[model samples]
Target: MSYPLRRRLWAAALILGFFVLWEVLCLALQVSDLILPRPSQILATLFSRMDVLWPHILQTLWTTMIGFALGVIVGVVIGALIGTSRIAYDTAYPLLIGFSSIPKVAVVPVLVLWFGAGPLPAVLTALAMCFFPIVVNIATGLASTEPELEDVLKSLGASKMDLLLNVGLPRTMPFFFASLKIAATFAFVGTVLAETVASNKGIGNVMMSASSNFDVPLVFAGLFILAFLGVALYVVFSLIETRFVGWANRKSDFAST
Candidate 1:
């Protein structure tokens, strides 16, 4: 088989093996459906309750995508500014680190209070959760640019704008995309958490309701949906990265093997 086909088959086998092991363990332990439902049980519940769950899932997805886009825009703009300026980097870097260190979850209540218990709060929560990683990744990538390259650009009398557009931006593309994958996952988590705390609509609300009603299987189903969404977003971002950063990906593959 070709390498790509072999990789696809391997991925399928891995997933199948995982489910088989999970099913075996659950059966052998006779795990209670209330405490830990098997994958089959979760899948069954998900399908059976699709009508109830689909709207909530769509709501969460909408908030997540909006917040993620906003966060990425803000992050890239601020990151590029800081990355390109030594004074700005020194001045803003410490504050960025300090804010990023603050537990993002702790701000959920404040966001709800400020934005009210709706999509706005949830979107803001996701934006806050996702922004930091992009900034850090872009800044790091910018700082790590080869000094020789900068020297060469300077020798060629490249303007600051030229250097930023031609060299700095391209170098930071991989980091930007990498952070996007991380941020997408975080954005989902943040939106869900905000929904759990404040909103009547969203997957988190469904999960919360399931928990309160002691619907263990349903709770697991909600979790499964969230996990699937995160994976889907990650895969989408990875495809984007592969398309845009083909050279970087090829280099990475070569380094690894």
Candidate 2:
């Protein structure tokens, strides 16, 4: 088998082993389903209630995507500013750092108070959760551009915009994509946090409702759904990264082999 196939097989085996162990432990210890439902039970709940759960899943997915998209746009703009202009970096970086330092959960209430619940607060929370990483990565990528290369481009009469479009942004592709993977997960967290606190829709709200009724299996199922969505988005971005920046990973792939 090829190396990639072998790696995939190993991953599948590990996941299967984990579920098998979990099932065995639950059975052997007579663990109460209320505390930690067996994987089998969770799967059953997921499939059985999927009809009811579908709409909430869509809500959460939509909210997360909107937030993540907005985060990317804002992050790129701010990062470009910080990376390209020393004055912006000096003026804005500290404030950005302070904002990112605030717990996203804490901000969710303020958002809900201002926006009054529903998808808007969730979307904004996800946006807040994801903004910092992309900003940092983009700024780092732009800042890392070689000075010698910049001088050569300038000597060739390249305008600042030309240098940014042709060289700076291209050099930032790898970092930007890396940040996307991280930001995707954060976006989901932010959405869920807001949903649980203020909204009546989405997986987070579903989980909250389930927990209130002591439906542990359904709660776990919601968690599984979130995990699945997060992984799906991560894989999508990974494929896009490979398509765009496979060249960047060539060295690392070779070294790993």
Tens digits of per-residue lDDT for model 2 on 1-257? 99989999999999999999999999999999999999999999999999999999999999999999999999999999999999999999999999999998999889988999799999999999998999999999999989999999999999999999999999999999999999999999999999999999999999999999999999999999998999999999998988788878776674543
Q: How far is candidate 1 from the true structure (C-alpha RMSD, Å)?
A: 3.0
Over 1-257, each residue of candidate 1 has an lDDT whose tens digit, in order, gives 89999999999999989988988899999999888889999999999999999999999999999999999998998898788788999999999889878776788899888888989989998998899899988887887878999899999999988888898889899999999999999999989999999899999999999999989999999999998999999999999997787777676565544
Q: What TM-score does candidate 1 reach?
A: 0.91
Quote the positional error of residue 10 for candidate 2 in Å. Answer: 1.7
lDDT of 2 at 236: 96
Q: What is candidate 2's TM-score against the reference?
A: 0.96
The Cα local distance difference test for each model comes to: 0.91, 0.95
Worst 10 residues of 2 by lDDT: 248-257
Most TM-score-accurate candidate: 2
